[model samples]
Target: MSAMTTTPRTVTVRTSAAGFVGGIWHFARREFRDAIASKWFILYTIAFTVLAVGVSFLSLSGVGSHGFAGFGRTAAGLLNLIMLVVPLMALTAGAGSIAGERERGTLLYLLAQPVSRTQLLLGKYLGLAAALVCSLCIGFGVSAVVLAWRADGVGTGSFAMLMSFTAMLALSMLSLGMLISVISRRTGVATGVGLFTWLTLVFVSDLGLMASSIIFKLRVQEIFGLAALNPLQSFKMAVIVNMNASLDVLGPVGAYASQTLGGALPWLLASSLLAWTLAPLGLAMLLFGRRSSV
Candidate 1:
């Protein structure tokens, strides 16, 4: 009798756990299949691979003629390309996710399913994230193999670090894009807003900050603090400090900030990126829940 009672309890607990996970996975799998078949996925994978391989080749071209080149220069080149391309890819992918569903009249059907709003939203995000990871692995993995074969003195550690930061940046942008999607009721508006946000972060923020610093004669700490608020800036600073051999490439302001902060720069920048990733997603969830309840 005791064994039968214990078995029932065990079965109940297992069922509960499975139910909780099963709901999320159902939508996740569906969205993943859709994303895999999307045209954007194909373009992203091809573009990223081509850019990565091209950057590696150009960086290593000096090996035969002038002097030795390695992953250091390749990483720097790739960083610029990634800072431009990955954000656009992630932002567009995220921006279209929810709004596109709503536009197609599928979001209502999705909401009426057994899953809660939280599970549905979370599942979609994870599905998109998984697709992004798949693209990154294919793109970066191919480049890494090629570089290892062709380049001399390839710093695998630095390359890996760059890849890590790239993923973080992608996640950050994706969260922001989701927030925009939630706020905008239409897919067209969401796409436009996403592009505007990307432009502001990639170009306007850096230019405006640099101009302000120059005009105001901002101190090193002031510049760093302001720049840290922008994910792109933080990512650039973090990559420069961690990957590059010297701080000179970051210019005077960055070098001074590095000198002033010492070992704390990486942690600060990482914290900023983490905040960028989480805060937007939380806000989006809150807004989404409220709208759905209404």
Candidate 2:
């Protein structure tokens, strides 16, 4: 006291902000790790390898001596295979992301760490998206390489473009899965809902197009525009249109929409895909951050 007391106060500040890119990497890595560790995805990959070998063999048959059907059929078949498998990857990767965290009692611990809610969401999305990319590239790469070993190679560019559109499709699927995980309280419930959602989006969407054709009195142009709002239609449209560039197998309305609203299909597809991915995670973060897990 006589020496004049000196007092010190300790201060701790936690900004917990990683730049956006870092968040993306962090999330992307998490997705890869999760996918690698998951037994189900591993099993699926093995099965996929077997099927890809068979498909590659057939697609590569008589390489240099084929008509248009050979090339077209091979391309179409390969695209179909990609379309089928990629969604499963997306669904399995994302279906359990947040809900499973809650199941494991680590949601609190993760949030309590030096990471903000947004970072958690973005990181997870990025991780999941990266995993999706890996799945697609690996599947596509295997097919491309095997086909190329012969006298004539598959159209790598066409395969790549088709994959690009498929990846975009996966983006929407993954986001929806994540939202289901975040919204649902139980992992099993999330998973069931996720699968159902995937099935409906993938298969039942055509019903929507048919319904529009039957119900609406609108011109062909407006019908396609409205249908484009259905994410699945956009997904297929992106793939088909990009694959052929002039193939409007989608019909006059589809062609018109492509000329008009669907013309920005790339940007719109990206936006919608990202929206589905981000929105659920955003909601998950909000719920998780304030959630009474205690």
Candidate 1 lDDT tens digits, 1-294? 354544433332333767867887988898889998999999998999999989878877856522124777777788899889989988988899889988888889888866677777777888888888888878888878777777734576777788888888988899999889888878999999999999999999989998999899988778878888999988988898887533557777778877777788788888899999899989988899989432
Against the true structure, whose TM-score is highest? 1
Kindly report which residue stretches of model 1 are placed more than 4 angstroms away from their true locations once superposed.
1-18, 64-69, 292-294
lDDT of 1 at 88: 93
Tens digits of lDDT, candidate 2, 21-96: 6665676687668876778666766666667756767865765533333445566666666556667667766778
User: For candidate 1, what is the lDDT?
Assistant: 0.83
* Predictions in order: lDDT: 0.83, 0.67
Q: Model 2, residue 39: what's the lDDT?
A: 80
